[model samples]
Target chain A: MSLASLAPLVDAAAVGDPQEGVPLALYLAVSGGLFLLGLLGVLTRRNPLLLFLAVELLLNSANLALVGFSRYWNVTDGHVFALVVMVVAAAEVVIGLGLVVAVFRQRLALDVDQMSSMKG
Target chain B: MGERIVFTIAAASALSFGTLVVTLKEPFRATVALIGTLLSVAVLFLLLAAPFVAAIQVIVYAGAIVVLFLFVIAYLGERPIVEIGDRLGRYQAFAWLAVIGLAIQGFVVLATTQLPGVRDDPKQVGDIGSPEAIGRSFIDDYIVAFEATSLALLVAAVGAVMLAKRAVKSEGGR
Candidate 1:
């Protein structure tokens, strides 16, 4: 098959409803996948910094879905919600990084497994 | 067609960078990858007709928060210890499965709830992209939230300085 012939198939796989000029399903799927990846990272990674990044990814994935849905519904509420989410996310990152700094200073490490003193 | 192409590129780049953010072993590389993800997300925001929010995403998240993350990673230096063990157990597997199932069920419920005659409308792309519009709306409609956010930022700044100071003082004492 010619490369040009295969192009449509590839595009179709990545996006649905070309006539609509938007790929709602693809956006939703990718956002959900990103969220799952972040969730797995949080569950599996030992590094606190990586965990923090993963948490941010999870938040961003939700934000993407919110914006996508808002566009699909033709409403401004989704955009407003996304803005609020970003504000909350910023606050979260500040506090989270601060905590990481405090923990590292005390123990000289970022390993989540080693910080088990508070597990009791 | 141009819009579709832009959406495809933005979505692909965002997903790829997001994956790299988690998979990269070096904290610094992962932080850089996260910045890429944020930039891609900002592009997505613009494509969605939210130029104002997209600008804020770039300025606040990509510009400030990510720089802070990089600084933290750099300041910590290289600790010999790295990987932590898996925190999840078998119960977590079931928990995740249940959550996914519930999410799918909820989506089905919502999809079914749409009115029979409802039709998708073309987005009314507003003049909301202008700084004037955003400023006016923010001041008039969201003034309380905006002021609260400023206060929160103030508290965060003070708290961050205090946290860093304590660390410095303790190190000096030792």
Candidate 2:
């Protein structure tokens, strides 16, 4: 779903009574904010390693939102998706870090701006 | 009362640490904040009654993933800190403005909307998040996706090893 549709759902979730349980809106807000922060980091940062961390944050933010929705709907689907995403993220990191290591070893340039060989 | 209090604390800490992970100058410090952010999210998962997910969040994310990052940080020793001057271009200004606008919009939506019973009944969701239930669904409903994930992971492991070895050989040859 588009982020616009999610806005009211988040607001609606947040406005509910809290004594019964944690509100879905609060979870959504936190996850959304975290996701945005990670995006900003990815756009602004130069360090490849830091970029990796930012990407992790982005994935985790998505996972959090998924679990929240799963709980809201009372389904197991979100949990499974989160689990699979976790595996995918782990694999991505392994390969990405390996590439980073290899490149650093070759020329010791850690900044993204410096690695322009692929820019065509 | 306790749930609200815990949720407030966890949410606040998680957001702050998440921001730190993004804005910190030193990569190592950012890594630490990232750990804190993950741990706080784990607490939120626990509060949400998904104990299994919370445990995995700790073991895989806080433990394995962050440690892997630390290993990379150690390998790339003494990298220059991100310079703050002479780099903020026009796009950077627009990006910051966009972030602020989004935050304001989120605040407005959160403050204005009201939906009762948005979450499921506590009784209904109780078993759904448990490890046994999740595992059952994994085997029964998501078997194909699960199998694909395993295959992908194996390939990634092999690829990572090969890539690193090739890089080492090339460097040596040079």
Error of 2 at A38 (Å): 0.8
> TM-scores, in order shown?
0.79, 0.86
- Superposed on all Cα atoms, the candidates' RMSDs to the truth, in angstroms, are 5.7, 4.3
DockQ of 1: 0.29
Worst-scoring 10-residue span by lDDT in model 2 chain A: A9-18
Candidate 1 chain A worst ten-residue window by lDDT:
A1-10
* A65: Cα error in model 1, Å: 2.9
Candidate 2 residue lDDT tens string, A1-120: 234655544443453444456668778788888888888888777788889889988998999989888888778889899989999999999999998888887765677776778989
lDDT agreement with native, every candidate = 0.73, 0.82
**Candidate maximizing TM-score:** 2
Q: Show the lowest summed lDDT stretch of 10 residues, model 2 chain B.
A: B115-124
Write one digit per residue (lDDT tens) for candidate 1, span B3-103: 76787788788889988987899999999999988998888888777787788889988998899899988887775554444554545676567547755
